[model samples]
Target: MTTELRNQEITIQPEDSEVVLSVERISKKFCRNLRRSLLYGVQDIATELSGGKRTSAKLRSQEFWALKDVSFQLRRGEAVGLVGSNGAGKSTLLRIISGLINPDTGSVKIRGRLAPLIALGAGFNPILTGRENIYANMSILGLSTKEIKAKFEEVVDFAEIWEAIDAPVQNYSSGMAARLGFACAVHTEPDIFLIDEVLSVGDVKFKMKCHRRLAKLRENGTAFVLVSHNSHSILNICNTAIYLAKGQLITVGETEAVVRKYEEDLCLSGMEKATGPLILPKKSPDESFGLDITLVCFKDAQGNILETPMSGEPANLCVECFAHKYIDNANLGVVVKSLSGENDRVLYFTSASDNEFLKISPGNTELQIQMPYCCLIPGAYTAKIYIKSGVCSFDVVESFRFTVQADKTISRCLFYQPRTWKVISK
Candidate 1:
């Protein structure tokens, strides 16, 4: 597949077969104010009718671009994951592809039948029963009456709403509606599926079932574009990923790399929020009588600096400081505190005094702490560094924050311990 954006054209030539979807230089704009938005809509329609092209580059009052020059391609049997923070254009792009909305510029060409689970029960009739709604939704998705009948029981069984299949859908719970909608979409057997975070609405067991069904569909050569915040699901289901930030495409490549980039962005964003406008102290003559903690950072065993560390991984904490004058009996202490509602819990603590006292000169210094395995459970942690000169507090800084991401397969607690189990009696 080849995608070219410079010429405002995207072409996908499948090496072995046919191109399933091609998105050209797509762009979308929106207005912030409701009145201006309605006026802009009327003007856009009028301009289109008059055969006058309105450039998206020109932003009128209250207007902003939601997507700019976005382009990609998907071939037969390929799955691409769309990942981004909120308002990053993931949903807008999906809606554009699903034909629920139109882009202000560029074009989209999709081959074969398309089924979009962009919104849960987006097309369902409240007055209709689940079984009746199934027929309506599948028909809208390009399925014939006979085809819907053929897949009727399969959809109902997969949804696990047999008791409520004949009941009015408006009376069903959100999960039930989501399941029924998802079951209908997937059972229609479309050539391409555009899903936007719908898998997260169902129960865990049903979600697993959906994953299994998607895997089966993939094996049968159905292409998919999935928008989800769940990294594990994206990494497991897609070979390619697209990362978007602030309505712009940041990167598009292998799933692992893209997901890592997206996560790194999240970590940096959180750190920015924590450290905004806080200036670090520098070495100066006036501060000669005391110690000053300047910077603190964490790194993994592989020597990559981490803004976000994974739970149960080895990490190294490095603290940089400056001593303005010579001091005797100086001790440096480091504390890791977990933050929760109206409370702080000390997860780890250490002091240079516990090992050996330090004699400092008028210069910069660095301290390194190694954790063979950082078993602290996944949560936000703040690192506090302080200096004490013979029981007198010299200096302290307590504003560094880092997050530990939990492993999806594991049950997390305050900490993790390695253990072994065996059927000794057997």
Candidate 2:
């Protein structure tokens, strides 16, 4: 069944469509002070016992909203990524949906069984062996002993802990425990899965294995709600994404749009300390030098400004600057680097000097760097601009950020290159 969310209202395409999960006007609150919180909790319980209305709208001492009127739906075979900063109510929302926590207002309707892998080693008993914990956890998940026994080998195989299945779980490494938990959750074969950053616990090989298993489950009509800080994984797995901030739902739509909006918010929120690269001195163009970068944009092949570009598509990086002074031999450079701020992250770097030095007169000037086809990999990237006159640095701006989505055919390398493969007599 097709599912759509507009203005917090969930609509299924077909009249008889099956929705695996539905959240309506869900909200949660918390109090900062422990003593006051306990008192408020007791008061709320008393009010409930007396059949009186609970005061959820009004805030008491040190009370604040953890989630504010959030609503969404998930259908079978659908995957949604939750994106936000710390304390953005993502985890709280997931907990509410998983039935681990109740909302202060509104309700959640889940039609089928759900498996939540929220915290690592959450349900496992430290004193129990890995194998014994598997059975115990599955039983707690509402599975019968026979059912757990039947799936025991499958879980062990998936977790790849056969050598240590008999060992106590307290001795297992974090990754091992995470694998066991994930294996148990997936092997239960629930209709809906709620995951919160657990896929990042294991090694690369195991993570990929888990991703593949999740894809297979989706093919079998399982729905997923994934919360992760890794935007790449969100783009890779989820078709839709929801962005949250300060306990409020900011936007929910296509995955790329939501992720791009989240990144923009991060940049505006001053979350990333280091800006993009600076080829020259860090000085305002209008102060020390005589150039001011007014606008920076990325445009598609059709000349339409693009917020997100597709990999292998023709695009242009446009930089507009206002020059207060004239210069004879001024050089303009543009560098594209990964947003992680790690060494060796510069994907592409070039300068006007590579072709010929740019000679700009005084006043406003626009520079367009044309790419026949953008070959950069599919990920977040930042474009840094620099202008220099001979040995003196003029201006620099390093705030421009953009994301690239991979084409239909998966290209995993740093950049795509034109080449043909030929076999001469194997």
Candidate 3:
């Protein structure tokens, strides 16, 4: 692979296929202990210099494979999203392709110029101003001096950090540094672009800008290998997805299919780690003079308590609350949470949020809210009962458990309507 990425000597070879970047069974490993890591590095160097190859056939003590036998090919005008939980080697793979790191086995063949956005501003000189660093960074990415100067204003402008351009990079905030780094990488416009969660940092607007710019790059036949925890970003930007788990490829196919498979694994794993019922605890107990939640449950149309509610079907949410005093409208709601635990992931059935005024009089009461469509991806979930007026009138962490049984429709989308999380990772 004869590519022109800075500090990389991968020469492009004629391919029978028109792939832009080909990652063939790439694998990488890291030692947990820093001392062992340094020692092993020296030993490997010495062994190789002695005309002996470094052994990497199996795991060394205190070492683990961050990536193992992963392979993929990116064609021009296509984007592939890398989706996985943390420690899944997404970043490691990007570093390997970018030539920041090398794989233990297999080969990476590139057919054109490439840009790797591993850690934003990683190559920046801290003492230099942002403006100066841009020149240095882009130059290292294969830009000529004249080209850098020509695109100087555009880079700063796109980064939205014109005011900070002359400031020392070390003084810039994390967001600022990330913005400048992303802008520089994108402007390079290489045939293949590798991004590793750098987009997860910036604010929403800047992220939106990044997405739009990435779309433009795609239009120009740039292929992307994007590592993102955000399923929505992946679905929006990539034509396909590769799911990695514990350094192994789980699935690689159409974006939705791959994302759903990843989500299913997350749900199953969260459930395995969860204690019984997965109910969220109420932060505080209900006031004696306020409302009290008696029960919260989901039932099918037949009025039978739903043992396992399937996705994409109608179910009724019943919230039974007892009010101590008369109130014109007491906000009643249920919070849907994954079995994984506290993350404040909630779906509002509140009378206040939905403008359904509930007249609560002192006594036992029950309100059944109709969920015409349950968009929750198949998973074990717990719901919290909440009744609020001025303060949290009544909220209980205690509850029964419900499982949304997986179905073919679980592949609905990254953004299931109402308030939904694609997948909650522990």
Each candidate's clash count: 0, 0, 7
Candidate 2 per-residue lDDT, tens place, 1-426, comes to: 243433233333423257788787888899999999999999989998999998887777899999999988788899999998889999999888766777888777665667898986799999999989998888877689999989999999999999999999999999999999999999988888899988878899998899899999999999999998877678778879999998899999988778766765665465342222212332354465677676677776676777666776787877777777777777778777665213235554556547667767777777778887777665566677787866788777765666666655433254666456898996
In candidate 2, how many clashes are counted? Answer: 0
TM-score, per-candidate, Cα-based: 0.69, 0.70, 0.79
Off by over 4 Å in 3: 1-11, 272-297, 304-312, 318-331, 337-346, 351-367, 375-383, 387-395, 398-426
Q: Give per-residue CA lDDT, model 1, range 109-176, as digits (tens).
A: 76677899888797999999998999999999888999999999999999999999999999999999
- Point out the worst 10-residue segment of candidate 1 by lDDT: 1-10
Candidate 1 residue spans exceeding 4 A from truth: 1-17, 270-370, 374-426
Better of 2 and 3 by lDDT: 2
lDDT string for model 3 (264-285, tens) is 5665574553222232322223
- Identify the superior model by TM-score, candidate 1 or candidate 2: 2
